[model samples]
Each structure stands twice: as structure tokens, then as C-alpha cells.
Target: MYQLKESRKLSNTEMKECLQISKSEFLEQINLECSGCISALKDFITLNRKDQFISIDQDIKLNDDLINSQRIFKTFAKLQSFGESIKSIISSIFKKTAPQNNKKRCQLHSLKQNPEINIQEHVHYICNEIVNQNEDCIIQDKEFDYHLQNYLKTKKFCPSCKENIQAALKHFKLQVPQPDCACSIICFIKYDHLKCEIHIPYDPILLNALLNKAQIQPFYQHASTKEDAQEELLICIGLLIKDRLSSLYRETQTQEIIKYIFYQQIGEIFKRRLENYSKMKGEHKSQLEELEQYLKKEVEQKDKQKKKRQLKKQKRKEQQLSFDGSVRANYLQESSRRSISPSNSEKNLLKSFGWQGSPSVSPQTRKELEFLQKEHLQEINNRRKQLREQTKQCWCEWCHHHKQK
Candidate 1:
């Protein structure tokens, strides 16, 4: 019976046949005895009885057990189908959401035509100009040219300059009279050198204002041969101004040009003040050396005083030790005198009494006392022995007389 129950629980068909019962009867018995056993059998049959077909009963006590088994199989099949559906959905969403390319989008165009002015570019340009003019100077020509080209390519013009250049380039003939030369050499020259000769591309009034701020004259002046000294001085002044202007111009930004120009104008106004600061002589540097020596002397004096104090303390400690040693020696001498004086006197008194200067009895006196004690003990023992012998002889005599009677 146990074997049949186990077999039914295991869903073994041969064991099921051995039970000799219908499937409904077996399931009913399993349900009555153990619902878990019936469920386990249903699961095992669902897993292993793929080839065998069995009619499931709707009214069976284990109805949900069997239905759940079929439902699990159907759920797996639907999940497999859903995997494919999910892939399709993802593909469709990717297709619909993918970015598109549009080729006809509008872009902003710059209205001004001229290239930008860059401060670094201006520095590179000035550096090139200086190098070209002064070939003897130790300057790397190729490197400078490379830097200048890079500067030109990367340079951007200020908005004002761009507008002015675009207008000038657009209406070149109408604005300025044609020059004798292409003006390329003057145009490419350093700004300081071309200050009075070049015409800035702006309105005449604005150009005048720019020149005033730039501290440049309207036109280059020709020197008279008769005024050679004055011409030489003016040339010197112009050179100085040109150098200052070039340095400031290369470092100044377009937005800061006006401010830089104003700064330069102020610098010129205080030229004497600046020069005074530069030329003002300082006190002799040897004064610092003297002060250092004085400090050294003060430090040495302090060190010497410290050493003197240390020496004085050491000397006081030595003197105190010497005094203490003398006092201890005196105390020891006094104690020795007191202890030895009494002991020596006692020894002399003992020697006078015919006794050794020691606290022990003489050997002769000790032997005499011991001999007297031994003699007294011997007398006592002899008396006791004699009395005992007499008493015993009398008792023997008395006993012999009574026997005769």
C-alpha cells in the first residue's frame, strides 16, 4: 500500500497500474489523504507525461492543481512569444526616434568684410617689422614669420575697425584720393612708424578723434636743414614716443585702445615726474653693512655676559662644595676624637687592673668553678649508693631469722 501511494505520488504509470484504480479514484484518494502529494504528482505528470494524454476532470478535488500545471506551460509559451514582440517594439521605437539630417538650415553671415585685429597679431607684426629693420639683431626670422602668419590667420578685427575697413574697401575710390604707390609697404609697416603717414579708414571727424587719442600728428613734418639741432632733438623725441607707443599698442586690446591712448597722454604729461623717480639716487649700500656689524657686536656682548654669568654660577657652586667638604671633615674629626678618647681611657684603666683590655672572664677562673661542681656531685652519688646497700642486707637477715622460727 505504501509502495502504491509512493508510486502515485511520483506519477509512475506502471505503479499507477499496480494500484488497480482509475485516474479519478487515485486522484480522489490522494486529495483525501494529502493535497501536497496530489499536487506533486500533477507537476511530475505535467513534466514527464508529454506523449501520454489523460482526460482532466473539471469536478476533480485537485482541479486547480492540474489547471495550474497547464497554466505554467502556457505562461512559458506566451513569454517566449513576448520576447519576439519586445524586440520588434524596440526596433520600431529606435526607427521612429532616430535623429534625422537636414541640409538646408539657415546660418548667420558676417556683414563686415575685413579680418579681425588681434593684439598678439599686432605684437607679432611689430616684432617682424623690428627684425626686418634691424637685421643685425639676434632674432629668429623664420620663427617670427611663422608666428606672424599664425597671428594673421587667427586674428579678428574689432567691430568698429571691421565696419570702417568694409566701408573703405567697398567705397575705396570715393573716400580717399589714389596714392602714388599701392601703400602696401606703409600699410604693413609698424603702427608707430606709419602714425602720421597713414589714413585710418573711418569718418574724417572720427579719424581725427582717433589720431588725437593715439597722440599722432596729422601729417609727417619735413625737417629744415637750417634747423639741424632742433630737427635732431625732435627726431630723438619722436623715436622715444614711437618706442613707447609700439610697446603699449602691442599689449592693448581694441576695446582698451582709447584707455591706453589716454594713459599714454597722461604718462607724457608726467614725464618729468617719472624721470625724477628713475634718476633719484639711493643712500650708500655700505650703511646696511655697518648696521649688520652693529647688530653682530650687540649679539657678541650679550653672549659674553651670558658666559660670565654661567662662570660666576659655576664658581659659586665650586666654592660651596669646598666649604661643605671642609665642614664635613671637621665634623668627622670631632666625632673621631670623642669616640676614641673615651675608649682609650677605658683600655688603659683595664690594663692597670692586670686584666686584658677585653670584656671576657679569665680561663683559670672558669676551670676552677667547673672542678668544684664536679667534686660536689661525686660526694652526693657515693652517699646514696651506701644507704641502698645497707637497707638491702638488713632485709635479707630478717627473712632468714623468720624461717628458722
Candidate 2:
């Protein structure tokens, strides 16, 4: 609990640095509590184990049921030969002497011609039932008879035949268990191309015991997510293989697990993650490219708008500095004509009319000059106002864009 709390406070990178661990190790430590991640890991490990074992034990490929059924058939054939040989030898001994012990031996070998179980009745259903049930599939007397007749066209099996069936069932149970076996084992054997019997590495009882252990029992928990399932898969494989190593292989020198299962089986548990990973990677790349293009184009458009705004500012400044030289010349000429000439007025006006010559321009010329100046000022004010508005608008747009980014 203390470790879990400490792990929570530290960032993943910080934790890794403190522990001096690789990225994979750091992530694995974090997901130890996550259920779905554990489940998925278990699946991969199961496939891997199957692959590793099958390469070495290719001789046994078929399911327990079919193999058991064949054994019954073979045993029945052997019993027939044994009965004949014993009878022939006993007949010669009887001819030599009236032997009570010989008669008893012949009596013991003789049977009432009634057989209880029929091997031919449900031959096909055996493998399917056993494999589907996993390592712990059990075929009790009642269940065996039911499947036998259910699959086969025949009616019922005799007592003599029943004995052979029971023996075969016992043998099958030793190889495969009655309950709690992982589905992966049955799948491995059922689909093998060779379809023959392979050496089972563990005893049925031992395998069951290993499976029931608390640490591994959780591997059978239902997975809500693919990652969760994967985590469980990896853990289950690791634990099982570790157990197998100490029990059967007896070698701790080797640290790596064999990955023959990856080559041999592409089961759903193993294949889903790979498919999802590839698909997600492709989607991520395409989306990233789209974002980059959009950002680049937006930057380019902002630059263009800035250049246009600067050009408008320069044009407004030039218009403000400009003056109408022709208008100014015309105004001066009008002013000169409107004024009284000094030469014409000074000779006679002082002696004859005693009128003083006015030096100021006329009221009409002064009013015209004031009106022209007002019009020029209004034009300049309008240009300045337009430039101010453009600059303000540009600044507001840029602020909004930055905020969004």
C-alpha cells in the first residue's frame, strides 16, 4: 500500500528515474491494478505457451474424446484375441487331464454375450465436447452414454462395451481434467494439422492445482477492455510457465520464454491487439498531418493580412502629407484682384477723395480660403479615422487568434 501511494504521487518519468527501470517496466508497474490490461496480457502468454510446447510435442494433436474413443475400440479388439488364445490353450489342457483349475480359468474368461456401452454410438461427439470443455472436461458414465447415443445412429451400448468405455474415460480424465481448464489448450490440439496425440507436460491434478491458485485464478476474470484482457493473458502465461518450469523443465538458468505459439497460432486473443495497434497508428499519422497543414496555412493567411494592413497605413500617411499647389496659386490671384491697387489710389484718392487704401484682402476671398481649408481638414480627418479603425480591427483579430491557439 505504501508503494502504491508513493507510485501515485510521482510522475511516470520520475518513478522510472527513481527505480532505474525501462519504459516497459514502468508502465507495467502502473497497470498492475488495472484489470483489463492484465486479462489481455494473459491471452498472449497462453498463445505463446501453446506455440512453445506444440513444436516439441507435435505427436499428440487430437482431442481427448476422440483419442479415448479410439482406445476403447482398440481395447475391445485386443480382448477378442485374448479370449481366443486362452480358449485354445485350455482345450488342449482339458484333453490331457480333467483339470478343475483349468475349467475355472475357462469359466472366468467366458462372458454372457451382453455388452453395455457402444463405442460406435457417439464417436464423433467426444473430441468436440472434451476440447470445448478445456483441460478439466469429465466424461462420467451417464454423460458418456448420453453423448454416445446422441452423436451415433445406434441405440445403446452393452455391459462388455461399457467396461472399455469407462477405462477410456478414466484415461482421458488423467490427460484432461473435469473442470477449470483454460480454453486455449483445447483450441491448440483441436486445430493442429497433424491431429495426433502429443505428450501433455503436466499431470491433470497438478495442472488443476496450479490453475486454482489465487494469483492465477484472477486471469479467468472477464475482461472489459482489450488492454485489460491482454494484461491478464500475460500474467496467466507467466505464472503457468513459471510453474511448469519448476515442476517439469526444472531449469532456472533460462530467463526468456519461447514464442513458438506466435508462429503457430493466430487466435483472436493474440491477433486483436496487433490489428488495433496498426489501425490506430495509421489514423494518428493522418490526423497529425491534417493538423500541421491547417496550422501552417493559418499562419500564412495572418501574414498576408498584416502586409495588407501596413500597405493601407502607408497610403493614408501619403494622402495626409499631400497639398494642392494649383488651388493655392488660384486663391492668391483672386486675393490680389479683390484688393485696391496702391498706385491707382495713392495719386488721386489722397487729394481728390481723401479715401485711405485698404491693405487687407476682400471678405469673399477670406471666406473661400477658410472653406477650402475646412474641406482639406475633413478629408485628412476621414483618412486618419479609417487608418485608426483598420489598425484597431487588425489588433483585435490577432488577439482573438492567439487566444484560440
Candidate 3:
């Protein structure tokens, strides 16, 4: 607690200068606070072995009176309970079997950290190839998968990988935990294309343990803004990864592991973005098809309406033609009747006047011929008036045009 207070009061440079240590040493000391606590707890348990065993080697026995009467024992019990709960949570979150179990390789694989090559250049080259390669050829080539498995189990590594991991650790202000204290094992694999299955070791460090008032101080003294909060979170993640890397990977392999993890994350992010884009593209295509179908239906309906209008127009034209033909035929028949009737009337008048035998005509015969002529002229005038009225009433465009002319 006093060390923590001193750390809070001093800057990193000041702490290093005062402690007569380098920056790396200072970072290592500060980051291992949780590990130190675990060590201290183990020591305490060992010291109290006369009371009862609290470790997994034996079943734990509790005495109510001893727990209640002794404050130290009560505190120890509570701490033990808290530790167990933390272990449970960690187990649930990282539910994969440890690499030591030698289980089926598939069962041990994690999608987060799988890589075929830990070297940056080679990994980049493969990614480029994947992008440029045709889909048909890429699917047929199964070599990528075999190389992917090799990265995880193979001990061989690029010479520069360790240097890269060390640099990363320095930049993040983190240190690898001592091998003896590492709770999880991580195997970093690098590859271009495969199911993402990078085995990221679970860090045993608990957030609650770090945040405990009786233990180490918080990562940030005060995260007042959103940016500060995000920065603090990043710092916490770095610390956890640092702890995991230190314990899981040998000094020689640390660089490869870190590189693999870095590239795996990038690949996962890219894959997710591609999946999202594909979904959007599919939706767009479906919308276009729907629009096309709707337009086609609309056009078909319009055509049907157009055809109906044309049929109605043709039917009306045929009816008009039939009506006009009947009217013309009736008019022609009436004209013929008038022409024949005039001749017949002339014949009748001559017969009535008795002009066949006598040249001289009587006054009565002349008067009768005058009356018959006047009657015939009146009948012809009436028929002409009726025909003119019927023509005026015709509303067809062809008939109206002729009437106007």
C-alpha cells in the first residue's frame, strides 16, 4: 500500500531515478503487483499450514467459531472465496483446455490467434496473394490450412520475432511474467487465410483483484473523460497480454507469438467487414430486383388497359360503320321509290285526263291533274325534311366532318 502511494505521487522517470533502476525494471515492478499479491497469499497459506490446507491439494475444512473469533482467519477465508470466484469467472470466459493436455488439435484451437507465419513480410505477402488470387484456385489449394496448424505446434521461428515482441512489450509499458507464475499458455500461429483460431492465452489477473482498495491502485488515478477511459482500458489490456505472454511463451518465441496475435486481429476485423459488406450487397440486389418486378407489372397493367381502350374504339368504329351503311341504304331506297313514283304518277295523271283518245281536255280533268301534282310535290318535300333532320343528329366524327363540309 505504501509503495502504491509512492507510485501515485511520483512520475515513471522519478520512480526509476529514485529506485536506481531502469525504465524496464520500473515497469516490470509496477505491472506485477497482482502477481506479488498472489505470492504473498501463498506464503501466508504456507505459514498457516498448521491450521488447515486451503489449496486444491486437499479438501478445505471450515470451523465457524475459528472464522468468527479470529479476524485474520476470517479475512483469509474471504480472500480465498474471492479468489475462487475469480478463477470460476476466468474458466468460464476462456473455456478451452490448456495446451499441456495434448487434446485433439481442433479442440484446442482458438479463432482469435491462429496464424500461418509469424514473420510480418511473409504474412503480408500471403494476404496480398489471397486478395489477388482467383476464388476458384484459392478454394482448391488446401496448403494454407496445413501451414496454419504448423505455426501453432512448430518450435521453429523467424530470428527477428523475439525482437519484435520485446519492442511491443516496451511500447505497451508491459513485461512478460516469470515462467513459474504463468497461469495460461498461448501458441501464436501466423497464416494468411483459414478459420481464425489464434490461441490467445487467458490471463489469470482479475480486474476486481487489481481494483481492490487493499491491493494495487487503479491503472489511472482519474479517467475523467471518454478518451481517458479508453486509454485506461487499453493500458489494462496491454498489462493482461504482457502477463500472458511472459508466462506462456519462451523468450525466443515471444516475438512470433506477438506478431501472430497482431496479424490475427487484423484478419478477424477484415473478415467481419467483408461479411457486413456482402450482406449489404445482397440487400441492395434484392431491392433492385423488387423494383424491376414492380415496374414490369406496372407496364403489363398499362398494356392491358391500352388494349382495352383500343378494342372499345374499334368496336365503336364497327358500330358506326354499320349504322352509316343502314342510313345510306335507307336513303337510296327512298330516292329510288321517289323516282319510280314520279313516273307512275305521270302515267296515272295521263290515264285520269283521258288524253289517250281525245286531244282536247275538259276543265275538270285539268283541275284534277293540278291537285295530284301538288299532292305529290308535298309528299316529296316532307320526306326531304325528315332526311335532313336525321343527318343533323349524327354525332360520329366521320359523319360530323362530312356534315360540316
Model 2 bad stretches (over 4 Å): 1-266, 323-359, 362-405
Ranked candidates (TM-score, high to low): 2, 3, 1
lDDT of 1 by residue, 1-405 (tens): 332222233322322222132444444433112233234344433331221112233321112333232242332243234335433432322223332233221011112221222223233444444334332211133433344334223334344433443343233223344345443322211211222222232122322232333343324233233233233222222333333334444333221322222222222322222223223311233567778999999999999999999999999999999999998897666555443322454444446546563343334433543565466568789999999899999999999999999
TM match of model 2 to true structure? 0.25
Measured by TM-score, how close is model 1 to the native structure? Answer: 0.17
For all predicted structures, in order, the TM-scores are: 0.17, 0.25, 0.23
Task: Candidate 1: list runs displaced more than 4 Å.
Answer: 1-294, 337-405
lDDT score at residue 378, model 3, on the 0-100 scale: 96
Of candidate 3, the 10-residue stretch with the lowest lDDT total is 184-193
Pitting candidate 1 against candidate 3, the one with the higher lDDT is 3
For candidate 3, the per-residue lDDT at 197 reads 26
